[model samples]
Target: MTDKERLLQYCLRQGDTHIIFGYRLGEWCSKAHILEEDIALTNIALDHMGLGNAWLERAASVDSEKRSPDDLAYRRNEREYYNLLLAEQPNGNYANTIARQFLFDVYSVLYYSELLNSADDTLAGIAGKGLKEVRYHYKHSAQWVVRLGDGTVESHKKIQEAIDDMWRFTEELFEMDETDDIIAKSGVGVDVSGLKEAWKTQVSEVLEKATLSLPDHNLSRTGSKTGVHTEHLGHILAEMQYLPRAYPDAQW
Candidate 1:
């Protein structure tokens, strides 16, 4: 593929993760245990949605197919999506959601730190803004991880369990393929593999503060980067794309 196509694909992959994770976070809008958290999560979800759109718009600019941002986001099939499987998993409980957020936030911090200096001006600009928002997101979510994990015996057990359940998906975030290879070589994309060690250190510090133990299991399930995902993604698309699919070109 050409460099243009590679960049577009890379941007789309980033957008996909943001959009799907934003949607999952939105699921907790009214369901959070407290009103303060309810509003906080909703706002964070919106931030993610906005960030995702920015990347998608950039993707549209480079797309030879000339697909619009909305078209790329709402009209894509499961086989075409490149989001991490972790983003698509159901928000089982507050603790489960926090576990997912903490894991991704840690990775996002390290990912964007390098991305801020990317050779591609547009991607670098997006990373510049994204870094600020994700830093707040990481701090917000990390505190909760500590609270729930170190609070009570019951809370501790539940949060630890959530960590274990989500552990298998974490490795997928750092798996690099050809798309990443090209971008990294050109200094326009991050080498995800390099982020692994730092990500682990950051996560370990937070987990220690939370009094949570890392899962003994090292087995990680992947494939979302290759358009392979868990069953949950289909349901997400079904609900998320309903209006766009049912009313093509229709707008209120």
Candidate 2:
């Protein structure tokens, strides 16, 4: 692939992760345990959508076919998407949702912070705008993790289970490939592998404060960036793309 192709794919991967993750958060719109939490999750979801759109638009800017962000988001099948495996997993419960958000939030802060100095001006500008929100997102999710993990017996058990289950997927957040290599060489992308240890340290500190154990597993799930994914992504796409696919020419 050409350099622009690599950059396009890199942007698409980022766009996919945030859009899918944001949609997952949107699922909790009216289902949250309380009203205040409901608004908080909704606002976070909106932030994800905004950030995802920016990345997708970045990809569009580099596309040979001149695709729009909406086209990239809604016209693609599951195999065309590059979101992390963790983003597509079901939000089983409040704790599950929070656990997923906490893990992603931590990674976002680290990843975006690195992007702040990206050689690509559009990407650096996007990072500068989004990093503020991501830091707040990290704080919000981390606090909840501490609260639920250290709360009553039942709450603690649920949050701990959520943490353990989600830990394996965390590995993919730092996976690096040639697209990363090519882009990073050109100073436009991050070698996320370098971010793994810091991710773990930040995660480990939060888990400790929450009285939760950091999962130690030999196995890790991966490959979504290269179009591989679990079954859940199909379901997410079915719902997210249904309207746009069904009404291809409809205008807002």
- The prediction achieving the highest lDDT against the true structure is 1
TM-score per model over all chains: 0.98, 0.98
Per-residue lDDT for 1-252 in model 1, tens only?
899989998998999999999999999988899999999899899989998999999999999989999999999999899889999999998999999999999999899999999998988999999999999999999999999988999999999999999999999989999988999999999999999999998888999999998889997899986799999999999999999999998886
* Residue 201 in model 2: lDDT: 93
Cα misplacement distance, residue 90 of candidate 1 (Å): 0.5
Residue 87, candidate 1: Cα error in Å is 0.5
Model 2, CA-based lDDT = 0.92
Query: What lDDT score goes with residue 156 in model 1?
Result: 94
In order, candidate lDDTs are 0.93, 0.92
Q: Model 2, which residues run further than 4 Å from truth?
A: none
